[model samples]
Structures are given as C-alpha cells and as structure tokens.
Target: MDQGTSKGVSRTDSVDNGEGTVSKALQGSRKKKRDKVSAYERAKKVYEEIQEEKRKERRLRKQEREQRQIATEKYEKTKRKANKMFRKRSKKGQPNLGAQVEILLEKIQQKMK
Candidate 1:
C-alpha cells in the first residue's frame, strides 16, 4: 500500500500477515527449511529402496552362480563317462559320443552369450 517509496521496499515490517511483526518472515523461512528437510528425507528413503534392490540382486546372482557350478559339474561328469564308453567299444554306425560333448559345450557357450 506504500506506493510512495522507491523500489517498493517497506520499512514498516507490514508487508505481510497484518500483525506487523517480523515473526511472519521468520515463519516463512522456517516453513521453507521444513520443506527442504522433508525433501531430503524423501531422497534418503529412495536411496534405501535402491540399496535393498541391490541386495536382492546380489542374492539372486549368488544363487544363480551356485546353480551354474552344479550344472557344469554334472556336465563334466557326463563327458568323462561318454569318453570312457567310446574308448572301450565302438558299435557300428552309432553317433560319436564325443560329438555330444561338443554339443553340450556349444550350448554352454550360447548360455554365456
């Protein structure tokens, strides 16, 4: 209401909240601080959620590694068996068992890819 001043800066502390005290400005500043704290809290919660997801992903990776190790062991055992069987006797026109090992190796390579 004081159009008589330069740059519209009020010196009377009556620019807001009709009480004509500095408390209104203080309250506004406090509300801004509270909003900033709340925003920080929301960001912290999001960080915690991302950490939890990383933990879950690590657990799944460990489980998958164990499963792969077991499968590889089984495949190697089967390979050894076939090699031994093929070495001992050759039945006419039967497919080469070594070829099965090659196929299994190719499948393992494809899985890695």
Candidate 2:
C-alpha cells in the first residue's frame, strides 16, 4: 500500500492517526484535574436542602395537630353547655320535647359559629 493513497481507506478514517491519541490523553488529564472541594460542597448543599424540606414538613404537621386540639376543645365546651341548658329546662317542667330539641339545636349552631 502506498503512503499517499490506499484502495478503499482514507487518512481521516484511520484511528491509528496521532490526533486521536493526543485528544484521548488530554481528556484523561482534564478528568484527573477536577476539584475535589467543589464536589464536597455540592454534596453538602444537597444535604442542607433535604434537611430544610424535612423541617418544613414537621412544622406543617405540628400546626395541623394544634388546630385539631383547639377544635376538639371547642366542641367539648359547646356540648357541655348544651347539656346543662337542656337539664335546666327539663327541671323547669317544660312539657314540649320538640321545642326543647329545637332550642338545643339552635344553641349548638350558635356556638359553632
């Protein structure tokens, strides 16, 4: 085979050319020269972000629990007041059961509001 020309092969298509070897060597050096400190900083930043998200979630759950407790207390207070009023009215000899029920319902609705 002649150095200038080959039967079906071109000079650019040959991997044995020197350019390919030089480029591969440069790429290897570039990878080895990367900063280790930057990688550590990136990992630390990711960890902090995850911790912040967890804190937000915990705060939201606590607020929901507090709201539930408040609602329960309010409901219990309303129930006790209604029961006391019903007993007082009964002891007074109010004979109409339907009127007493209506009064109890109205009191409950007013307390809820």
Candidate 3:
C-alpha cells in the first residue's frame, strides 16, 4: 500500500487511470443529494395528511350548524302556531277549550324549567 498527502487532504487508497482518478469525496456529494429528495417527499406526505384532517373537521362543523338551524326553525313554527290560535279565540271574545289547553301546557313547561 502507498499513502500520499496534498494541501490538507489525505488519500488512503486510490487508483489513477491514464486520464483521471476516482475518490470518496465525489461520491459523498451524490449521497447527500439523494437524502435531500427523500426528506422532501416525506414532508409533502405529512402536509397532505394534515390538510385532509382539517377538511373533515370543517364538514362536521357545517353539519352541526345545519342541524341547529333546523331545530330552531321547527320550535319557532310550533310556538307561532300556538300563539295564533290563542289570539283568534281572544279576538272572538270567547274562551275556547283548545286555547285553554295550549295556555296551560305552555305554563306547565315554563314552571318545569
């Protein structure tokens, strides 16, 4: 075996062709490039997964908002109908059985709360 040194670099084993030479330093740069591409691919996959999870959460929130709106509309329609029925009987100046029942039921519900 032969050893040589040149300008702060050391070579352990090397072969020289008629035109050029091969060295470990040149191969190390190619390995570094391969590592960079792999790291980029892994990061891209993680970002996509995060976006998908956010989309699912948004969909769930939208459904909850729609359900709440539907429930509010139903309660308001029922209350409005009950009020209209009571007003009609009061305008006619007669106490009707149906209006009395509705008033009693509303009072009972308020007391329970």
Candidate 4:
C-alpha cells in the first residue's frame, strides 16, 4: 500500500518505515488564511462606528446651543416685559421711591459742593 500526498501533506510525512521520526513542517499551515474581503469588511465596520459617534456628538452640541439661545431669548423677553410694566405703572401716578431718594441725595451733594 503506497501512500501519496494525503490531503495536501507530503507523502514523506505520512509514511513511517518502522522509525518514529515525524516532521513538524506544514503543521500550522492547514488553517485557512484570512482573505482580503474579510479584512476590508472589518475596517469598514470600524469606520462606520467612528462616524456614528461623531454624528452623535454633533447632535448633542447642536441641542445644547439651541437650548442656550432659547434661554437668552427668554431672558431678553422678560426684561422687556418688566420695563414696559414699570413704565406703565410710573405713568399711572406710581412714583418709584428708590429714584426719588437718589435724586434727593444728588441734590444734597451738589448743595454741599
């Protein structure tokens, strides 16, 4: 019974002539090699993940900027409304005591000078 190349292994490695010597070559070569398509797929997957993270960060920053603009607008609107109310009250015979005190104090200081 003559043994030829057995499943890609050389014939010399498979046949033993009563001796116990075995070759260690080609022992790790039986595993399938990594193809180019699989490596490309992995790199593409990693790139897409990084792009998604960047998009999420941009979305969060955009939301924060919009919230800050809305808060500033609300503050400006409240200030305008308060000033309008104060002017209306003063026109309706309601004098601000703090303004009268400041005017009297300035008059007294000018007289002393």
Candidate 5:
C-alpha cells in the first residue's frame, strides 16, 4: 500500500530515505581508503630522504679516499727521485751519500705519517 513505508521510514523527508544511508556508508569507506593512501605516501617520502642522505655521505667519503691516495703517491715519487739523485752523487764519496739518503727517508716518513 505504501512503498515509502519500508521499516516505517518516510521518503517525503530525505533524512529518512535509503539514499542517505547508502551515501553515508560510501563516505565512511572513502575516508578510510584516503587515510591509508596518505600514510603510505608519508612512509615513501621518508625512505627516499634516507637514501639520498646515504648517497651524499658515500660520495664524500670516496672523494676523501681519492685525495689521500694521491698524496701518498706523490710522496713516494719524491722519495724515489731523492734516492736516485743521491746514487748519482755517490761517485764523489760514500759517506755523503749515506747521510743524504737518511735525510730523504726521514722526510718521506714524516709525510706518510
């Protein structure tokens, strides 16, 4: 006799209508899904930031290591050149050659330390 009288609710006022019930349920579900997406986005952003920081640190350490290696090589080359010069000068006297060699070795050790 009355289609709007389901469970004694009325269709004249939309508050008592099935449309409001269905819309409310959909809004609640959408809110939950949106919260989940927001949480995931925040976590992803933090992970990316941490990775970038680590990359920067690695690059800096690599640069420092290269610099130290270059310095060590230069010191070694200078020590070898000094020894070669001392050997050539040794034709004059052996005592002078020993003293010069010792000085060159000490200089090299200082740089290495």
Candidate 6:
C-alpha cells in the first residue's frame, strides 16, 4: 500500500509503519500556537479584575446601607407612634401613663417572643 496517499485514509487516522506512528508531525502542525501575554495586557486584566471587585463591594455596601436606612425609618416610625400615644390626654388633661406602660409591656413581650 502507498503510505503517502492511502485509500480513504484521513489525517486523524494513525498509520503504523512498523517503526512507530507517523502522525506526530501532523499533530504538531494541528495544535494551536499560544502567544505570550505582554506585561501591559496582564496589568490591564488585573486592573479590570480589581475594578470589578470594587464595583461588587460597592454594590454590597449600598444594599447594606439601604437595609440600615429601612430599619432606621421603621424605628423612627414606631418611635413617633409611641410618642404620640404618650402625648394623649385624658379628661383630667394628664399623660396616659397607665396605657403607655401597658403598650410598652406588650412591645417588650413581643420582642422577647
């Protein structure tokens, strides 16, 4: 058989010629050559990664700040409600201490639960 142009032989098909396989040169030629990365490209990639990390951290911090703001707003709303309740006057024109203490106790119990 003619080794150079065998019938139905493909480049991927290895041929044994009693010495060894003859596809090493073909395989080497088929492999893609890798180009070395330049220092500027490496630095640019590192800088981009650092910037991405900073953006992620900033987003996390913004979310946390928003959460804290929401908690503060809720606390302020409850505080205003409590102050309004304490400022209620009776027929005697005095602060409703008894009702305020009852409301405070209920809030404490709810927090404990």
Best by TM-score: 6
The models' CA-based lDDT, in order, is 0.76, 0.74, 0.76, 0.68, 0.75, 0.83
User: lDDT per residue, candidate 5, 1-113, as tens digits?
Assistant: 77758877554433423445445456667679877757678999999999999999999999999999999999899788777766664566654667676777877898999
Stretches of candidate 3 exceeding 4 Å from the true structure? 1-37, 90-97, 102-113
Question: Mind giving the per-residue lDDT tens digits that candidate 4 earns over 47-94?
Answer: 999999999999999999999999999989866755554455365688
- Lowest summed-lDDT stretch of 10 residues in model 5? 13-22
TM-score of each: 0.45, 0.50, 0.52, 0.45, 0.49, 0.66
- In angstroms, the error of model 2 at 18 is 30
Per-model clash counts, in order, read 0, 0, 0, 0, 0, 0
- Candidate 6 overall lDDT versus native: 0.83
State the displacement of the C-alpha of residue 63, model 1, in Å, after optimal TM-score superposition. Answer: 0.7
Model 2 bad stretches (over 4 Å): 1-37, 89-102, 105-113
Locate the minimum summed-lDDT window of 10 residues in model 3. Answer: 8-17
lDDT of 1 by residue, 5-91 (tens): 856655565345566545557868868987775777899999999999999999999999999999999989978876765565347
lDDT of 6 by residue, 14-66 (tens): 75557766675654554533355778999999999999999999999999999
**lDDT preference between candidates 1 and 2, better one:** 1
Most lDDT-accurate candidate: 6
CA lDDT for candidate 4: 0.68
lDDT of 2 by residue, 12-32 (tens): 544344455345456566668
Which TM-score value belongs to model 3?
0.52
Give the residue spans of candidate 6 off by over 4 A: 1-34
Better of 1 and 5 by TM-score: 5
The residue pairs that clash in candidate 1, if any, are none
TM-score, cand. 6: 0.66
List candidate 1 stretches off by more than 4 Å: 1-37, 89-113
Task: Give model 4's clash tally.
Answer: 0
Q: Looking at model 2, which ten-residue stretch has the lowest summed lDDT?
A: 13-22
